[model samples]
Target chain A: MAPRKQQEIFDATLRLVAEKGYDGLTVEGVAECSGVNKTTIYRWWPSKAALLGAALIEADVLGFDPPDTGSLRGDLVSLVEAVTRLLTERPSGDIAVAALAAAVRHPELDAHRFFADRFAREREIFERAVRRGELKESADPMLIVDMLAGAVWMRAVFRGLRVTDDFADAAVAALLDGI
Target chain B: MAPRKQQEIFDATLRLVAEKGYDGLTVEGVAECSGVNKTTIYRWWPSKAALLGAALIEADVLGFDPPDTGSLRGDLVSLVEAVTRLLTERPSGDIAVAALAAAVRHPELDAHRFFADRFAREREIFERAVRRGELKESADPMLIVDMLAGAVWMRAVFRGLRVTDDFADAAVAALLDGI
Candidate 1:
């Protein structure tokens, strides 16, 4: 019930998922790792998907402060870098991939909701650009975000390729200035 | 072992994966559906992931002719449309999502190989564009492909959004002329 206790559970869940993957993760493992009762976890989260989703959200694992970098390119590069880290970094990347995999089989996982929430949060960068006359009023914010993030996902997750240091800058430039 | 029989097995595997998610798919189900011996399927494919991968390859479910349209923009739109169909269409889309989900748990699935092979096959389009002076020699072909395909995957799979008819042209235009 306490915030500290919830953080412990969330951390334990992410750690277990990173170590054993989604298929191997269990409420019992979270319980054991976090020193919380399995009944308590279930009472709070209801199911493995629910538990994982809550942990991902409550732990702020995928959270980032949307940059207000003045220029659209600068803001986009920051956003891309943030996404690159989430898809390439340790526990977060592993947990995110595991969640994506699990979502395929379990629609109740509501991975789309996670992405939707993120897009909604990031929409402000584009709005700012449009207001400043930096971007067209008709620019599709969601599509732009999807293309940028999707490129990272394609390389890091799908291709098993490294997200190089220059990728964020290069991607933003290519998308913004055209190849 | 014959080509015809092998086709039957591959079709059955894809169908089973489409009907049941990768987690639900089994060699026995494939064998039953294909009217093939379970041992034969096992002897050839060895594992479920291998079987699924081979089925995807042998079925040519993801295959498309590289458009030789006179212009690079036209070719890219064609490629985007092809990718959209693969990600949004039935049986192929279902099988693809299932394979991708399975790949996350089973590294042996080698989904990267599938993408690699596709990229290799499509590389000629860029090569031709360069030869025709349609594209800059400094252009990153793989990044271009990844960004375009990534956008499709983001909309179709990640967001569960319908990739509209105009998306291909719009995306190509955005990437080519800058947003």
Candidate 2:
């Protein structure tokens, strides 16, 4: 397959997965949507999970380049806000839930690595915060990241609540100052 | 169908969903596993999503009754600990992820209500805490609940980290004392 064709196939995978969810997605559907041959897709990606994972990375479905806004609070809020936007503004949440379910059912898929890599970049804000003395040096960066992101996910995804700007501000405040 | 038959079918549905995930599970498979006919299952549950919801409730997949441990801290730890046990000790996490993905794919199934009811019981601890004057009267009980549960889920479910008793205590402290 040509480089351009491979990219087209990945783009098609993202569109199909986002629209149909992972289970409803098929190699044939990708072939149809991308105008690429099924044999070629199979030759490049052995399974639907593989195809989806590559598509996620290549398309930057959950990617974020956290901006350094000088203040830890500012940077953390932006990082979390980006997550909220991905989960709420786009079809990324559906794709994530689909991948999560698929990852649980098929352990070989290793979706955790994909998310962990993406989330690690967001964690850099905390490290910068500590250096700037915004947060206690002893604070655990991973825990802080987990708590902030987890709360957003719980409300927005699991509980089906809107991730409003007010909610984002409250989350950041609660994380910074004890509730 | 007899009451005993209904229980058996639900049990079978849980077993199949936990084992196979929702996408791979079929009404025919449940009937074969339970030794009940597919027609009977359809009569009881209009769809696979409905059947899985009922099975989840009957199986107590995310069920919890937290004991009021006098302090908000104590109760919160216990509630999170129970969530940890459910997600880690059993195949309940797989069931939850399965349902989450299914709910996303089929909006009419209303898995949110199913989880809302189960999670509402866990929220009672926070209510008790507010009543005891352990937490501020103005605190948003729902947000508190979301943060606590979300942190545990991020680590235990998303990060695939061990939700140790120590980790549970730390999570409660962080929520109470701010990060």
Indicate which candidate wins on lDDT.
1
Q: Alpha carbon lDDT of residue A103, candidate 1?
A: 75
What is candidate 2's CAPRI-style docking category based on DockQ? medium
The sequence of per-residue lDDT tens digits that candidate 2 reaches over residues B1-179 is: 67678778877777776776666778899999889889989998998878887776765445556668888888878877877776777566666666665666667657777658767676677677778888777677677777777787888777787776687888877778876
Evaluated against the true structure, the overall lDDT of model 2 is 0.75
Deviation from native of the Cα of residue A115 in model 1, angstroms: 0.4
Instruction: Give the TM-scores of the predictions, in the order they appear.
Output: 0.93, 0.87
lDDT of 2 at A43: 90
lDDT of 2 by residue, A1-179 (tens): 67677777877787777776666789999999999889988998898888887776666545568769999777778767877887777567766766665666566666777667766776777778777878787777777777777878887777787887777677777777767
DockQ, every prediction:
0.75, 0.57
Top model number, DockQ: 1
Off by over 4 Å in 1: none
Model 1 C-alpha lDDT per residue in residues A1-179, reported as the tens digit of each score: 99999999999888887777777889999999999999999999999889888877668665667889899999999999999999888878888888888777778877887788788789999999999999999999887898889999999999999989999988888888898
**Compared to the true structure, candidate 2 yields what TM-score?**
0.87
